[model samples]
Target: MASFKTVMKSGHPPTLFAAFLYFDFCFAIWVLNGAMGPFITETYKLTPAQTGFMISLPILAGAIMRFPLGILAQYIGRKNAAITEMSVIILAMIYGFFFVSSYNDVLAMGVLLGIAGASFGVALSLGSGWFPPEHKGLAMGIAGAGNSGTVLAVLFAPPLAQAYGWQAVYGFAGAVMVIPLIVMIILAKEPPDSEHQSFKEHISCLFTKDGWAFSLIYVITFGGFIGLSNFLPTFFYEQFAVTKVEAGRLTMLAAFMGSGIRIVGGYFADRIGGIAVLSVVLLAAIGSFLALTSTPSLAVTTILFMLCFAALGAGNGALFQLVPLRYPTNTAVSGSMIGEIGALGGAILPNVMGFSKQYTGAFATGFVVYAVFAAVVLGCLFLWQKKWVGAWVGPRGKVIDPTPAQLQAAGRLEPIAA
Candidate 1:
């Protein structure tokens, strides 16, 4: 593994920093409604189910948009793709502030905010492309840590909404987005040799067994991470009877812890192995989810949720670390595919919790289901390691080249050299 200075020398720092800022602000805006969920419910007099859908629309819309944005990043450039996303956010903010009046109006704004959510692939492409292979995990993790922007939303949005109404939150987000937009325009650039690929090339990379496997694994890690991030505010409000601002403050702490730990996760992935890190995190998540099912006190629930999020953050870094190693030549497309599929979990989990609460009068059923799923995913990961240890694992435990036979068995026609 590279030292911090060595890793720093491997990529253009200004661009990487800009990528982090871009992703940070995008994420803050993407889940703004989640932070404002309690307030929105009060204002709109929405049912639990309605509140769930409100938080979900942006997540689902973002998932839907990520694939195309990934493709677009290749065609235009990651920087350009990000610029376009920011432009949409500005427009969306204007609409949200001036035109939105009803629940449906807020729902429509969520769809537009989905463009901000779509920046996941673009930011990853921008930050990871500039870094050396051995350091990509750390690079991507730092960039992905922009997810800590959720802290900004949850910590501040509710207070602002309380002071000025939910519409004010959008205006504030728009203002905050401007700083990153400017920095990105000035500092971010496409890495050299990032030539566009044909649709067929992308398809060949995306439509494979390994591709789907990565997607499923990402769904659990990133999906669970983001799903819980968006829903925690609602969970806190309903389960604890906290005011919106207090709920935001608690969720803010959890989001900050989770997002910051991702960098450590990435660094460890470079040193140990992505699969190794992922194994530990999935196991931790399974335990945490199971704990949640017990419906412990607020303090216990908060601690358990924080522990779960910390593991998810680490798993996210570890998962992307494997991507460049397994599909070096197709990282952009494969990352996009995995990211898009994984992100759909964000939309799905909130609905699960909401419906569970509505019908079961509690959230234990949803927690149990997620825990079972995490355990199943962990089992599959262990089996995968057993199957491809030689080809995919280096003698020193880093990613290495796979043999032709190994490539074929993994559903790839060619092996990407390490």
Candidate 2:
């Protein structure tokens, strides 16, 4: 087997440590409220709509900050930006414990936790930068799976809140985060090619058709993942009238499976192709959506989320496979843009589900919306086959050589690898 150092010079021991530490704190911050949501709602006497905001506001904050954070990574080294976010998350969590007095306090913490949410921007650019493209899927998959922070937070934080009081939960998080933050600062290094770009150049990348396509595809895959991540407890609460404890348990199960499966998805995207794997995952997600719409029994819902929706989990892994290939030279920019776009999906879908549940009283309508989005994605994959994919090649290598017209459109130079 090729050694890690052989495959990627940037994957130095120190930099890899930095990547893991940064993601650990960031993930903890993103899911902190979810873990504490039931307690906050009960304590504050917040309505369902307000509870929904308390759970989702962090995602919104994260989404809005991602673009700017992506731009920030370009100016500061990815390591600095990434570690600074972790430091900020530690502050946010501590502040919530010390300062949050009412529902407004929770809201304030959610907004501040956005700093943690934007960690994706840093992780996307920083982690992927540390490895050669050939190893990125699996390497980044493991790093991305730090999303298990949600699972960990929900698994531990809810129980912790029940035991020590919610204030202690925040305090514990703040204290726990400090270790990884220090490790990240000491171990992480800069990308050799960390070039700063002007805001115009960054925005210019966003304007391309490919960028929009990436955003749309990501919104569905990532949006659905995060939407369900935040809303799973709520969905269970409404559908089955389960206790909040039981609801968080169900969510924990799904999250564990979803996050654990990303490593497999990343491996396959490296072997089969990101598009091929994603195409199958999207179709499966459509089926899962239909299953979710019908409101099955408890055992069935668990199976639906953990077993059938495994594809959606895999799709998350598969999507990033396309990221590095899309811009080999500008991996940092491309990776960060993909993250910002993907994070946007995370922000929008939860809110959409919130309003849907508020007005219509069921998640069935949101199901249909996701189904339509999936179908459109499938159709576009077929229609654009000639342009998006005309050659058969596995992940990690085999860069696409553009035609003259394609060259002008992409505005990047890469050799064809077929």
Q: Which candidate tops lDDT?
A: 1
Q: In candidate 2, which residue ranges exceed 4 Å CA deviation?
A: 1-10, 196-199, 390-418
Ten contiguous residues with the weakest lDDT in model 2: 390-399
* Candidate 2 structure lDDT: 0.71
Q: What is the lDDT, from 0 to 100, of the residue 42 in candidate 2?
A: 78
TM-score of 1: 0.94
Report RMSD (Å) for each prediction in the order shown. Answer: 3.1, 4.2
lDDT of 1: 0.84
> Would you list the C-alpha lDDT of every candidate in the order shown?
0.84, 0.71
Residues 362-402 of candidate 2: C-alpha lDDT, one tens digit per residue: 77887788788888987776554445564322332233544
